[model samples]
Target: MNKKITIYSENPFYDKSLKTRHMKATIFKMVTLSSLLFSLGFLIFFLSDIVIKGLPAFQQTYIQVDVTYNEKTVKSTRKAVNKEYRRLVSRSWLRTIPQQVIDNPNLMNTKIKLWILADDQVDQYLKGHHHNLKPKYIQSVDNLVKNNATKLRFNIIFFTRGDSKIPEYAGIKSAVIGSILTLIVTMVVAFPIAVMTAIYLEEFAADNLWTQFIEININNLAAIPSILFGLLGLAVFINLFGLPRSSPLVGGLTLAIMTLPIIIISSRAALRSVPDNIRQAGYGLGLTKIQVVKDHVFPLAFPGVMTGSIIGLAQAMGETAPLIIIGMVAFIPDSPNSIMQAATVMPAQIFTWAGMPERAYVEKTAAGIMVLLTILISLNAMAIYLRKKFEVKW
Candidate 1:
């Protein structure tokens, strides 16, 4: 009979070691959670500040005034409104009075009460912002407020018009349209070329020194400062090719060059995500390599490719440095009708407005930022939706 003794070998510090490990893990988790919370707090603060400052720009102050559209008023728009209200009314709005009468002859010789746009100073004072309004003009605005003659109406002109020297008359229409056109050109030029380059490099090209060099350059281009691309565009497109300096064509071409590396990298990743077995299956069916890639692999990768393209476009849409370098910062007051026309994008417009020395422009700048943020958020959401919608589980 053998007496079996159970040997219990436990270190005396085992419990202490376990407790120490647990304490370290708990501390790490707390640190990470604090960092996450801190980031969220800052985001909330920034969003709240932007919203609060921007909301007022959607409404514009209008004053009810009696306008006599006669010969004298047509000659001198200041005579359209009464003497006391002339200082309160917007000069830009008043300048349009003669044209309005010319377009509608019935308005001539009519004594009608109308709600008209107020001066930027009057608008600021009404919105409780800092204004350089004279004491008399401030008192006049207060009186109108008391009598319910001044009201903040939805600013339809802000959406319909273009940039103006007057803050109240300025709008983002030109910038918005320019952005759309520039993005269109960017997508049209970059998308097909990038996808083809990515397909060739990832699917067909042999892995050699030349291929490795190209791959390295593409990666390096992605990391290059965007402003350098602007310089390249200035040198190649504008200087060498003689493309219009501030045109959307030049801006788009420039942005396309900058966006190419991003789309290529992302498209390659998308193509690689397709399993090799899919290609093998296509080849088993006696399909050519091109047919295998075109018919079998591309469709599956299309969603991811689109997602990356959209994200890249969104990034390009918000970029100002490159466009500014190519002269897209020019003050384009009218929406561009063609790609060859000089244009300014939303970011450039925002930059311009942010520099203006007016209290009203502060709200306009914030509002422009809000609009830009909304568009960017929508684009990112679209990318997410596309990824989720077409994702293959396998």
Candidate 2:
């Protein structure tokens, strides 16, 4: 009878195991949220700083002038200065500014400075045997003065012009061209070589002592000082091969050396992510090793490989030390016409401009950093998108 009356109690914190699990889950979520907030805060701060410091690169101020070119006022008939060509041409820019200001009165008070055109092109036009300064072709003279003339100003033109010191006239055309060329050169030389090396090591090479040594060596290459590569480039490309100093080709070569290890390691990792079961299955199906890797392994690895290459490119894009050693930091006035042509990359340009005595250069450097970072982020985004797009499902 006593055993039949068993008492059962329900605890208020019922199911202690559930309570403990809930507490742990709550802690994990809090930690994860806190970490995410901290990371996002840091990123926002960095981006805000870059934008604030670089905003000046967009705004520009110049000195506007009215130029007059009368063919009747031809002073000399010499080959250099005859037919009112030289003066008329010089006067051309000056004439255009006044008309611009007249057409847009808001520009009247805007400071304008005439840009220094190479070859004294205005002089040539003034000296040429032109009948008269065409009324339709009134010369406009707007000289670039201080780059920091307007607050919160954005100058798309300055970003487009190449590196130059032609007073207010210099454009970023050269720097833009050089950046594009540098990227192209990097992709061309680095992409295929990286893919091939990765394939050989992952799919072809035997896992023996020699291969182990090679792997060790490749890893070591990643740790080599970038400056050492620069020194190597200086000696090999400049001193030994007699390549031109400051050429994009030299920059590309140095960057390739710097990037190769990254690409190799990344590609190998990608290839290894392929499950061994997949390979075994391919073999059971009577597929060759090459076919197994080509059809199954390579596809899975491509995403990771592309991501790694993009990361390497991002690093290369921001590299300045190696380029400094190779003389790529020099100011280039015109856009590069060929790979052999000398050029300045955005990072190099930013470095050089940051050291300039003018405050304007500081803003420009900040702007350049922003641009460089933007491109890197874009590349990363592309890699992420590609990863999601091509990721294999099990």
Candidate 3:
């Protein structure tokens, strides 16, 4: 029986418009949630990778033995050994290890190998400490040898030691002095020049063709490749000015030039961010142009300027190509005593170490990288703190 069924469009309150709106809202929320999750995932992955790669450098290997001054053994084994010394010495103590293990026989079957510590550490111990390194009771094992044997205290002495042919012995001495000296040079030179230029352009300079040209140049300079500045430093500072090649002074000057554009741009932006009403108020109060800009404009821009300077320094700190072009020595024969002496920055040191044939050097390079990353992170933290401290919300 084909009965005519009443197919009413408004049988129920089925508002297609409201239904469509609800569907759109659901889609919008899903899209937003998806975007947020994707962003978080990328960030987590990146941070995890960096931490994993960088954390190993801070860990070192060591073996601690309850080293007693076996005077008879010391006298017999170490020719001309000092008797008055009462400090736990290095690998010279190892001579006792073989005999001790031999006499005990229990240790002979144990898995503890004696040659875990590097030979140089052994030499240092025999020489006696310039300072006392005596711990109350050492469990007795060698420190910092090839392959992952045992984890030991992270040695801060890595920072104090001189350059070594052995990668294990190489520490911050290779590039710390050089990198620091370069930063100092950059700060000393860059800050004044950038501040002055910013002031002139923003305050005194006419809004004309020349000013436009200068602005263009500054922007272009900021965009220029860092290696080009290294080339420029090589050509001008090293060649024309007869500055020593690969000297910290040269590296600093090159970095300063590279950093200037950023400083100028940031300073300008900071200056512009200041309220025009403040400038007008200063004018109304009969302040000179210099006084108004210096007292008001500069103070407002200080935080931004600092932020830019720090970022620039961080960039320069990690630059290797430019320093390489300028003949920065990856291996400095001695610790640099002056800016004129040849030097390698931390990045250069890292580059050199990463290219090392030995696997141990890979760890050393990673350690060096960890150190570098610490410095950068600390600098960035300081910048953020400064910005927060001085930020004036409108």
Candidate 4:
């Protein structure tokens, strides 16, 4: 009998497959990192543009006018400013001079110098932006600046007042208040229902054709165009239900419909992330499925659910299309005192400003964008913090 010797050798096919997979993985990682960098770069460019356009809104150009509050000038406040410089002063300020004199009658035909806001033209020029200002108006502004009469002041009106045809009088306060009311309604209506739906889908519902169909439709709804939700709101909320158009209640209801899918999808994902072994362990302890999910699964998933809900709310806060469809874009200068009253939201306010013919609106729109961006960033940051605090690693 011949002695048989067997030699063990590395499997060439397996070695080749291993090397190929390593190369593909390296390529995929490079591609993913490059894409991330490209996205971050684009975001930086966008934010930089918004900041450049918005910074000018925080400071306003003012010109000192030597007002001769005579009976004639008081009657027609246009005479308070020099004939050449009248066009360089804010018309809103010109209209208020007569009222100022009526309130404070201490000066009759007095030479009281007052620092009043300059025109949009002068404001543009002061900020080195191109304008259609005449040579004479430019000279007047230059002379005032040379005499230390024209200066930049911190704008307080932008916060305290409401939207105005005149950019100088336009403010975000009304929109801010309206947004608060609308979001309050949205949170109240959407949060609990979304949580319940997630709980049902994840725990109690039987896995059947109907459940599969519902799941598919929900995923589809999440991908639907937001504008379609707006149209739906216009049709259902405004037409069928006859809810007060432009009211925060209507706007919130519209947004709530739009937001529901997102919260449901996110909450379901959170519930699904709990390990099967955890549920098995709960059953091992004689706990029912309801108790297992409610006690064991939910506590672990709460952070994720909370994070998703906040993210969805933040998205709703920045939405404008649905509100516009529901007539929430109405020029509301006063803040709504109740959800039932007609209101305007911050995003709608920004959209309205962005469409104005006035150059001042460029800055106002940019400033509004900045504020919106800040709110979104803060919300995202909070979500991240909550996720970090409660996230479980298994």
What are the per-residue Cα lDDT tens digits for candidate 4 across 276-341?
A: 899999999999988998899988889899999999999999999888888988898888899999
lDDT (10s digit) by residue, model 3, range 300-370: 78898888788777877888888899988557746788898888888888888788765545656667877
Could you tell me the lDDT of residue 394 within candidate 1?
A: 78
Best by TM-score: 1
Candidate 1 lDDT, tens digit per residue, 34-147?
Answer: 999999999999999999999999999999989899999999889889888889999998999889987999999999988889999999988889999989878888888888
How do all the candidates rank in terms of lDDT, highest first? 1, 4, 3, 2
Clashing pairs in 3: 63-141, 63-142, 64-139, 64-140, 64-141, 65-140, 90-125, 91-122
> Over 4 Å off in model 4, which ranges?
1-36, 107-109, 276-296
lDDT to native, each model: 0.92, 0.69, 0.70, 0.88
| Per-model TM values vs. the true structure | 0.94, 0.69, 0.71, 0.87
The model with the greater lDDT, 2 or 3, is 3
By TM-score, how accurate is candidate 4?
Answer: 0.87
lDDT of 2 by residue, 1-394 (tens): 5542332124454554776899999999999999999999999998898898776455543222222323322232122222322333333234344455457666533333333221222222222312233443223211212332112224555666676453224445677688778778887898899888989998889999999998999899899888989999999989999988998998898899889999999889889888899899999999999999889888878888988898888888888888899999887877888889889888888887778654445556787788878888898898788778877666
Name model 1 segments beyond 4 Å from true.
Answer: 1-11, 14-24
